[model samples]
Every structure is written in structure tokens, then in C-alpha cells.
Target: MPEITYRDAVIRGIAQEMARDNDVVFLGEDVAKAGGVFKATVGLYEQFGPLRVRDTPISEQAILGAAMGAAMTGLKPIAEIMFSDFFAVCFDYIANEFPKSRYMSNGQTKCPLVVRTGNGAGSRFGAQHSQSVENWCMMIPGLKVVAPSSPVDVIGLLAAAVRDPDPVIFLEHKSLYATKGEVPDGEIVDRLGTAKIVRPGRDATILALALMVPRAVEAAERLKAEHGIDCEVIDVRSLVPLDTQTILASVAKTHRLFTVEENPRLCGWGAEIVSIVADEAFYDLDGPPVRITTPHIPLPAADILEDMVLPTAERIVETVRRSLQS
Candidate 1:
């Protein structure tokens, strides 16, 4: 097994898919010669060449539009929207075009494309650049949403997304780019709509995704050590075809549930999960499900304010402890 940073895994994932499939192509701003704004795509340009790996102009609309065209025309294209928030600019493609293409055409057409973006806070990029907008894509009926939390997942899920026969939103957390993890050698491909129980416990279950995953795990460890409140921490790797079975089973065993989300409290993905639990697994819960989330407001630029606004491990510990005690 080799340990690698999440950033390098991005490069390897794209390279692996592009190498295996000639139909796979990548395009985005600064992704070619500059290796991306975050330097995550270094060596791709030289390896794949200009035709396969390209740099696009500064327009999210043009980026996704071209990607949709390429996908519909039998090319598997991976398009990058520099920031996930910019999806608002190309809502038509995401909301109407790419997703509905195959269905609208009565399965006569297929749009197999991937929209990857830098998502989530922790870079102090302020409100516009720091949103965890997986919730936005998850709401659409035809889209498959994926937010990978580790280096291995970044590779495995990216491979899976590239090969799928439909549109996929692959969210890469900006804050997690530097984190390192162990990845087994070989061609790694993972299934979509699966939740991983990173730390298993019997008292409660804490659901989180992307950057919130590590925070929830830390909080779970602290709670067990200090308060004897063991918690099962589940990394919700995929949100669209959500693994509700895993979530419900965890809640059934633990009899308690809590969600830690980086998205704002209003309409966050956790709200949907809580609703599902309440509707289907309400009797299994010993207490009301709790949601620990960022306040419903635009993110602040100041480091102190950003720290206070995002859901922290300390906040998770405090919230879980207080809720259980009450």
C-alpha cells in the first residue's frame, strides 16, 4: 500500500480513466498547462496531450455545455467548474439538459459526463468560492452526486463516475486536498450509493460527508473517551442514490442519530436524511434526531469568523453531548 495526498489522487484518477478509455477526456480552466488553480492536475497535460487534456475559457456555462455535447456525441468528458458555487451559472445544463437528455430522448441518447469541482470551505475564499453545494446537485432527479472524503475514494469514485452511463457531480473538498491516506495498489473502482462506517459504535450514529467526515470521527473519539458516549461515524460518500439502508441500520442498532453537515442549516442534505429517518425509522430512535450544521448565512472571510461559522469537531462534541444529556 502506498500513502498519497488527496491532490495527487485526483491526478491519478483522471489519468487512470483516460488511459483505459480513449473516449474519456478532461477540460477545465487552468487544468492543462497550469495544472489547475490548486495544482492538482500536474503531469496530465504532458501525459494526455492537448486533444485529451485541455484548458477552457473562464465560463462555467461554456464548460458544461461543451461537456454535455461531448457526452451526448459518444465522448466521456470530465468538465471542471473551478468553484462548485459557479454551478448557479450553468443551472440549465445541470437542472435541465444533461440530466434529462437520456430520459427525454426515451433512452435513445446517453449523456455520460462528469462535472468535477472544488467544493467546501477551509481555504478562506469567502462566500462565493467556499460553498459545499453537493446538496444542489443531489436535489435533481437524474443526477448522481458524489463527494469523496479520502485519497483512495477520490480515485475509486472518480473512476466509477467516469465510466457511468449518466451525468455525475463529483465534489472535491478544497480543505481536504492536502490530507494523506493509504491507497491499495491496483485499478481501484468503487460502487456508487454506498456509505462507509469509518468508526463503528453502539450508542449512536453520526452521519457526515466530505470534510465533515474527519471532524465527526474526531468528535466520536472524544465523546467516547470523555463522556463514554460511543458513536458510529458514517462517511456518506454518495448522496443521490443515498445508502439509506446503511443509515437506517446504524440508527436501528444505536437508537440515536445525529448529522454533521458543512452546508447551511436551511435545506442541508442532513435535513433530507433526518426526514427519511423520521418517516421510516422513527420508532427505532430513542431520541429525536439532531442536526449539527453551519448557520443559515453566507460564509465570512475572516479566519476567526470562518472557524466559528463552520461545524467544528468541538461543536459536534458539545452538541452531541448536550443533546444526549437532555
Candidate 2:
């Protein structure tokens, strides 16, 4: 095992995938020489040469359109969109084109493309640069959305996304890029739609995704220490095609559920999960499932206001407590 940053794990995953399959190509803004906005693709151009690792124009539409074309033409393309906020520019290509192309062609052609982007608020990049756009992508029919919380999961899920036959959106939290964690040696591929129960407990279940997983785990530990409450933490790594069975099973055992998400409460990912729980495991609930999410407003540039807007460990604990009370 080796301790590496989430960014390094992503870089290693891309490099390994490129080495394994020559069909895999990397393209995005400043990805070739500058190694991407976050340097996630650093040294890739030097290793794979220009044709495989290309630096594209400053248009996400162009980048995504080119990747979709390459994918349709028998090549696996990994397109980077700098920030998740910019994905709005290419929603037509993604929602209408990339995801529907293969099915529209009667499964004759597969769009094996991975669109990687950075998301979340905490870098003080303001509202434009920081937004959790995963929920928006999850709304589409033919897209598989994955958000990894730690370095190990980041590497594993990225590799899985690259190898997936359908169009996959791999979202990396900007705040977790520098976070270090132990990643196992050799290749690892995490199965899509599989929820991981990071901490097992008999009391209550907390469903979290991406960076929220770590926060939930911290809050679980704090609850156990302070109030003697055992909270089970389940990481829903993949948003679309969510592992509803696993979540329901956990809720059945714990008899209570609380979801933590960085997105806003209105039309947030938590809403979907809560709906699923209500529909499937309504009888298993000991109390109403509570949701912890950001305020329904643009992320502020100031650190203090940003902290107030986003979900935190303390908020997660409070949500769990409220769930128990209700």
C-alpha cells in the first residue's frame, strides 16, 4: 500500500489505463503542456506523446463533442472539463448526444467516453467555479455518474469509468484533491453503483457521497463518543444508478436514515435518496429520514459564509440527532 494524494491517484489511474489500452486518449484544456488546471494530467503528454494526450481549445463543447466523436469511432476518450460548473455549456452534447448515441444506434456503437471534472465548494473560487453539479448530471437517462471521496476510491473508480462501455461522468471533489490516503498497490476497479458501508453500526444509517463520506464518518465517530450513538456510514460513490438495495438494507437494520450532501437541499441528491428510502423501506424507518445539505444559494467567496452554506460534520451530527428525535 502507498499513501498518495487523490490527484496522484487519478493521474496514476489515467496513466495505467493508457498503458493498458492504446485506444484510451486524454484531451482537455491545457492538459498537454500545463497538465490540466489541477495538474491531474501532468507528465501524461510527455509520456504518451501529442496524439494521445492532446491540448484542446477553450470550449467545453468542442472538447466533449470531439470526445463523443472519437468514442463513436472506436476510440475510448477521457475528456476533462476543468470545472463541473462549465458542464452546462455542453449539456446538449452530453445529455442528448453522448448518452443516447449508442442506444439510438441499436447498440451497434458504444460511446466509451469518460468525462472527468472537478466539483465542490471550499477553494474560495466563488460561485461560478465551485458547484456540485453531480445532481444535474444524474438527471440524464444514459449517463453513469461517479464521485470518489478518497484517494483509493478515486483511483479505483477512475479506472472503472475508463473501462466502462457506456458514457460515464467521473466527478472529483476539488477540495479532496490534496487529501492523502492509503491506496492498495496494483490495479483496482470499483464496481459502479456499489455503495460501501465504511463504518458498520446497529443504530442509524448515514448515506453520504464523495467528500461528504469523510465528514459523515467524522460525525459518526463524534456521535459515538459524545452521545453513545452508533451510526453506520454508507458511501454512495456513484450517484446515478444508486445502490438502493444496499441503502434499504442498512436502513432496515438501523431503522433510521440521514443523508449528507454538499448540494443544495432543494432538488438535491438527498431528495432522491430520501424518496427511495420512503418508497422501499418505509416500514423499516424508526423515524423520518433527515437530510443535511448546503443552503439554497450560490456558494459565497468569503470563507465564513461558505462554511455556513456548506454541510459540515457538526451539521451532520445535528441532523442525525434530529432524526432520532423525530
Candidate 3:
């Protein structure tokens, strides 16, 4: 294992998958010559050349439509949306058509559309560029959504997303791109739709998705060291095929649940996680499941305001303590 930046891990995943299968291709605006907005696909253009690694026009509708058409015909395309918030532009292709083709065709169609997008509201990108909309994908039918917490997880999950035969929304956080972690040099493909217990505890369970996972983990540590609270941190890696069993089992032990997410609290993914506990393991819970999320408002472009809008480790710790007390 070697320590690598999150950006490197993503490029490695795409490169490995492309080398293994001839059908795997990367396409997006500025993905070829510019090497992606975040440089996730840097050096790939030189290695794979223009045919496999293509730069599409600056239209989300066109990029998604073209990718769906390519996937249906024969090629496996990994289309990149520079920002996750821009998904609104291609809702027709992403939310409606691409996901429904296989279902409508009744097993006749194989929808292997992989849309890799960067999400999150940090680094002052503001409301336009920095929105965590995983909940939208979770609500859609026939879609598999994946969000990795670390460089290692991204390597495995990205590889898994690229290899999956269904329509996979591979999501990465804007903040995690520069974060470094250890990753295996050998093949390590994570199982999509499966959640991982990132940190173990017994006092309470903190379910964090995407960018919140690391913050929750840090909070769990602080809670244990400072307040003598052993909080279990679970990263809900796969949003669509959520690991309900894993979550239920953890709740069975901890008896308290706290969900942390970057999306607005109103009808967000955190509510769904809390709803699941209320439905399945209500009797086992010592307190009501609490959701820690951004207020129902858009993130400000100013760095100071953005810091206040997003959930933090301190916020997670405070929320878990309050829930445990109740």
C-alpha cells in the first residue's frame, strides 16, 4: 500500500478499468485537453489518446445524451459532470431516460451508464457549484449511487462503479480531492451499494454520507476522548442500495442514531435514514434518531458563510451528545 492523493486514486481507478476493458471510455467537457476541471483525469488524455478519452461539447444535455447513446449501443462510457449541482441541466437524460431504459425494456436493455460527478459545498464554490444532491439520485428508481469517504474507498468504489452493469452515479466530494490516504497497488474493487462501518462505538451511532463520513469519524474520536462517549460512525457509502441491515445491526447495539449530511435538512437523505430506524428498530432505540444537516438554505459564496452552513466535527459531536442525553 502507498499513500496517494484522492485525485490520484480516481485517475488510477479509471486508468485500470480502461486498460482491462476496451469498452471503458472517458468523456466530458475539458476532460481531454484540460484534463478535467479538478485534474482528476490528468495524464489520461496522453496515455489513452483522443478516441477513448474524449472532450465533449459544453452542454450537459448533449454530454449525457451522447453517453447514454454510447452505453446502449456497445461502449462503456464514464461521463464526467464537472459539478454535481449541474445535474439539473441533464435531468431529462440522467433522472428520467437513462435510468428508465432498462426497466422499461424489461431485462432486454443493459444500462451501463456511469456518470462521475464532483459534489459538496466547501472551498467557496457557493450554492451554484457546491450542492450535495445525492438524495435526488436516491429518490430515482433503477439508479445506484455511490459516495466514497477516503482515497482508498474512492479507488475501490470508482473501479466498482465503472465495472457495474447498471446505471451508477459515482459521486466524489470537492473537498476530498486533495486529501491523501493509503491505497493498495493491486486490484481492490469495493462492493457497490454496501455501507462500511468506518469507526466502531457503543454509546451511539452516527451515520454520515459522502463528505460527512470523515467529519463524523473525527467527532466520534473527540466524543470518546473528551466526553467519554463511544459513538459508532457508519459511512452510508451507497445511497440507493443502502445497507439497511448494517445500519439496523449497529442501532441494535448502540440504541441511538444520529445522521449527518451536507444536504438541506428538509426532505434530505438524513430524514430517510432516520425514517428507516423509526420503522425497523424503533424498539431498540434509546432516543429518537437525530439528523444534523445544513439549514434549509443555499450555501453562500463567501468562505466564512460557507463554513457556517456546512456541518462540522464539532457540530456532529454536539448533536450526538444532545441525542444521547435525550
Q: Could you give the C-alpha RMSD of every candidate to the true structure, in order shown?
A: 0.7, 1.1, 0.9
Is 1 or 2 the stronger prediction by TM-score?
1
Please write out the lDDT profile of model 2 over residues 1-326, one tens digit for every residue.
67999999889999989999999999999999998889788899999999999998898999999999899889999999999999989888878998887788888877899999999999998999999998888988899999999898888888889999989999999999999999988888778888899999889999898888899999999989987889999999998778888998999999988889899778888898899889988999888888888888988999988988888999988878766765
**lDDT score of model 3?**
0.89
Candidate 2 residues lying further than 4 Å off, grouped into runs, are none
**Which residue runs of candidate 3 sit more than 4 Å off their true CA positions?**
none
Best TM-score goes to which candidate? Answer: 1
- Count the clashes in each prediction: 0, 0, 0
The candidate 2 region of ten consecutive residues with least summed lDDT is: 317-326
Judge candidate 2 at residue 51 and give its lDDT.
94
Candidate 1 Cα deviation (angstroms), residue 140: 0.7
User: Per-residue alpha-carbon lDDT of model 1 for 132-168, expressed as tens digits?
Assistant: 8988888899999999999999999999999998899
Q: Give each model a TM-score.
A: 0.99, 0.98, 0.98
Q: Compute the lDDT for candidate 1.
A: 0.94
Off by over 4 Å in 1: none
